[model samples]
Target: MRTKSPWLLFAAIFGASFLCWKLALEPHARSSGELERAPATAQVDVPPAPRATAPARADATPSAAPTEHALPPSKQRVRVVVRLAADASAVAALGAELLRVDERGREHAVACCNDPLAPAPVGPRELAELLRAQRALPEQREATQRFELAEGGRYAIAWHAWRHVPGTLTWRTARGAGEVFELRSPFTCEERTLELVIAPEQLSLDPALDAPVIDAVTHVTAKDG
Candidate 1:
């Protein structure tokens, strides 16, 4: 028998090697590429969540202004003292009132005869060039506490006018005709006692030529707080 050629044997070996690479090595490389690409495409997208925060704070309440008038009221006593010019002449009072004064010296009616509890007008008054500017209140009716006395021989009479808060206050009285009289000085609310002194000249005729004239109105005090 003749021996096989060396060249044919080499060709047969190369052919078998090419077949194994195509069937096994190429198929495994394709499968690995598909697996890697599948993992990347299957990922899902998600959104981030929001953060929490606190709300703002506010004030509890607002402030207010002061009020008028006082609390826990008290009573006031009034006394009247009159002097006659002579035995023949006489003196008496028709009505009386109490007035409260402010820093501007403006007068406010605290008590009146017709309406004893009338409140003072609330507002600024027109300014004038007087030591104490007297302002006219709206629909302002003349007020009095109550003064009923006769021109009898009696020299004085004592009565009560009720509550009178003592800040800067004075008394007003009707002299005779349309005459109006006020106390000389303002009084504090301490003792709250007002003693009105009427002179003889105010009630009757004038005194003698040489006689000295006295004050028209005056008030006496006991003690103060």
Candidate 2:
């Protein structure tokens, strides 16, 4: 171990082959160069996948129809009752006027009785002394009027008087059908309960006239209940 100069046995086999390639091939080539620069495991940007939707169909489209003076079919609630007889001292005071005719003949006065004892006299002997002081006293009376009618058709009631009175007018029908009229003195008559055919909740009327002055109408139907 002392004659070693072949350059110290080639420098002890070149320092035991560089210390066994730095402990086994430089620790597996420095762990494959630290798994190639160890930082390539940071590459994230993944998102893409989603699409689906379809549903809705059932025949749809249709609406509009109603107009022809499209408003007049709602009115029902009628009640009228009137009764009067004459000869109460030759009528010394009395008055009445009520009118309502429709079927296109249009004329609606409604109701009134007494209230003109003056302001309407220009002559004719002061309107025959105001119609002889409105019949010098005496009147048998009964008058009840309530109105509203519009539900479906035909209606009429016309009674007039300036003198000469007698009365009776009735209307009923909810199915009982009973219309009576017996209004005398220039009332003339063709009968038909003064014309009526109403329908939709039913008819109603009552009128009385016993002259001194009278004009009347009765027909009804109303609603709000």
RMSD of each: 44.2, 46.2
Off by over 4 Å in 2: 1-100, 103-133, 140-153, 156-225
lDDT tens digits by residue: candidate 2, 20-107: 8777866445776776663321111112112112111111111122223444234422333322323212221222222444556665
Report the number of the highest-TM-score candidate: 1
- C-alpha lDDT values of all predictions: 0.29, 0.30
Please, what are the lDDT tens digits per residue for candidate 1 over residues 1-225?
A: 136677667768887877887677664447767655522211111111122121111111112222233442133223222222232122112233334444455544443334323453333221221112112221111222432221111112212211111121322222421112232212223222233333323332222321244664656678632
Best by lDDT: 2
Pairs clashing within candidate 2: 76-222, 76-223, 77-222, 88-138, 91-135, 92-135, 92-136, 92-137
Clashing pairs in 1: 112-144, 113-144, 166-189
